[model samples]
Target: MSIQRVVAVVQDGAEPFGLGAICEVWAEPYHPDDDNPVFDFTVCTEHPGVVTGRAGFDLVVEHGLEAMADADLVCISPKHDFDHHAPAVVEAVREAHERGAWIFAHCSSSFLLGQAGLLDGRRCTTHWRYAEQLQRAFPKALVDPDVLYVEDDRIVTGAGSAAGIDAALHLLRRHFGAKVAATAARRIVVPPHRDGGQAQFVRAPVREHEAETLAPLLAWISGHLDESLTVERLARRAHMSPRTFARRFRDETGTTPLQWITNQRVALAEELLENSDLGVEQIAQRAGFGNGATLRHHFTRVRGIAPLAYRRRFTCIESA
Candidate 1:
């Protein structure tokens, strides 16, 4: 089923990145490129306004838990004190689930689901560090520590940090399709797919040296997405061996040269589609896809819709 309304429920001491991942996935920008809908996204808390973040910053939320009443999807974002139960938040999720909203949890947020009695007899997962505790707390929960995420009975739970992105994309794929999901992934510069069962591994943080060294090259590449961006050519441009450049590229951007270029091109094509009157072939040329067919091929593969269809979505001029 297609979901258009999304409500993320947050509590005090929310984990910043965990909440950010939920917003990143559900707070979508309209790209009819895939016949995608603009989501009506809201972030609600039990007590609205000045919600404290685990990272020391505070969020000024405007809505309360009642905002979840009509949501098509409800996400429980992780908090620093996830094990601590808030009765209002728990009951809110319980009601949402009973009313047939798609329920999701990120990291220790799964514990909230357990408190709501939603995880009972449901296969779910959480961060590896908390898996055992979660299983013990909710004995009826079939918690799988080995998986990145788990979805059962309209409920989804993901491991800590960035794994939330994987679980969100999985939900997007379920509502839309692989192409639409892939397009969203590209927009965020994440790998298009990661299986739910993939082992959670340590991700190295980018060192300052890597970003500093590659800053100029990355800027240049962004500007030249319309040009041939082969790794060897880029390596030469960076004055490094192809092998060293490839490794450095990954280290800096978390993606390879080719993938980065392709993502940039797709982004450019999307922009042109939204704001330009250029024909498909012209848009393709400008975006470095070379021609309409190539643009269509990639657009269809990534966005699940053709260029013309994408353009038509934005063609109607709205009166102010």
Candidate 2:
């Protein structure tokens, strides 16, 4: 096998937490006696000197952007500031991509790539707080705020903090197969592959109600997503008029009843598609999408892939 050379570009005010996460997976000798290092990683920066990290630790870099010329992969860890991206840093990323190097950026480093114009016309994600800024700064790049990461062509970006691990594992899987990725994850004590689209920790809109509002009914609705559900039917179950139930449902759940049901149904469909032998029709029924066509439409809309294709690419039944 050919050696894999990777360069991690660091800068001032860089989040060492993200840098450490990248090193733990890619830089360290994960498989000590397996013959060779999985990656030949070099910590690089614009200036070849002692670079201070956000946490006050000194990171001494020996290589500059010139390192990217010979690198198979170029990685960038997140920095704290979103507004003041260095032009030199952006040019290095652009040059690396132009030379056909696989570009990986965790968290806010994606903003750097966006600044460099490499992420234009590509779907990308970053820390949710910076989502608006990323979109405003690079209108050509499609900014997805909810996903853990997005892989558009050779450019891969992971969302904030721990989500970087997910993106790194995905890169591992793409290069070395699920087995190698799993081995690396076991060494690091993390899941080998997390479906990258898992939501960033979002507070559930529904709150507990004092009276019999819609909690039990909502739970029941989740269980029977394939069942024909309507506002009037749900209201009857809650023993309230349709109009009163609609208003109360909004108050209790913090979302309209239909929207809440659709979200749950989609989540259920995703689980079935990932874990079970069920066909599209069966998954749709179980997840309350009505039919295979409906499931396909919503699945493609939300996940950007067909159900079978997603299963083929991501299902780890053998590994699990």
Candidate 3:
């Protein structure tokens, strides 16, 4: 559904950054940029008054739970005492979801969704630190702690900090379009896009040990994404056997060399498509796809949208 009215349900111990991130995206002031949707944003609680913040300060909330009845989107901001939830707030959340409003929970706030029974049998997540607790508390919830966020049905759950921004941007892109999301990102000085499936900062120890050893090689590979970077070719340059190089590459980068190369090529093609007026074939060759068909194949598979379509959606960024 199109999001117009957005209400954030903040309780005692609300995390400042979590609520601020929501305000940064959906509660933006008008800009000269065209086509970005402006939302009617409100902050509400179980009762309207001074809501104690998790940090040291407090926020004055003017609206009560009644504000969520007509909201298109309801955000449950993370808090310190996440398990301590107000019964009225939880009921209000369930009612909002029952009425078809999009429900988004950031970090520990997902626990509230669990209390509201919105996460049972749903693929959801919370901050990594709280994922196990959330799962243990709500055995029916499918909690995936490693991902930046998860969108199951209309419920969105994001990890802590920047991942919350990533989740909000995903919603903007899903409902409004990439251009609108990109405008919000630029205003907030964050990236325009980060896939919801991206990792949430935790890495294996093996990768940590090998990442520094391969950092220089990875930088070289990024600069030469247009070249034929076969495992054998890269192994020779790294002064190791191809088999050894392949194993080390995987451990260090968490992906195959071909996958990493293709990802970089796609990123380069995206930059050219958004910033330069180069045709598909030219961009394809420059990004090492070698042909328009190959570029279109990889681009569509990776981005879930065609190259021309993405370009059309973001072309105005050049002037913006």
- Model 2's lDDT to the true fold? 0.78
lDDT of each residue in 1-320, candidate 2, tens digit only: 22299888888888988998889778876446443246788988888998878886878889887888878888897777755677888887888788788888899888888888887889999988889989999999999888888888888898988889888887775655445566677777886655666665544454566355566787788777888889999889889999998887766654577767776776676667666888888888788787899988887775567777766765754211
Screening candidate 2 with a backbone cut-off below 3 angstroms (N, C-alpha, C), the clashing residue pairs are 225-288, 226-288
The TM-score-based order of candidates, best leading, equals 3, 2, 1
Candidate 3, superposed: residue stretches over 4 Å from native: 33-36, 202-320
Q: Name the better of 1 and 3 by TM-score.
A: 3
Write the residue-wise lDDT of candidate 1 on 1-320 in tens digits.
45888999998998999989998988977876655557999999988879999887999999999999999999999999989968998999999989889999999999999999998889999999999999999999999997778888789999989899999997886566555777888888997766676656523464567544787887888788778878889999899999988887766555667766776687677667766677777778888888888888887766556766656654542211
lDDT of 1: 0.82
* Tens-digit lDDT track of model 3 for 1-320: 78899999998888999999988887887777645677899999987899999789999999999999999999998888999798998999999999899999988899999999999999998888889999999999999987788988889999988899999998886676655777788878897766665567633353455434777798898898788889999999888899988887766555668877887798788778877888899899899999999999999987668888888776753321
Stretch of 10 with least lDDT, candidate 3: 202-211
Question: By TM-score, who's the top model here?
Answer: 3
User: Can you list the residue pairs that collide in candidate 1?
Assistant: none
Model 3, residue 100: C-alpha shift (Å) = 2.0
Q: What is the C-alpha lDDT of each candidate?
A: 0.82, 0.78, 0.85
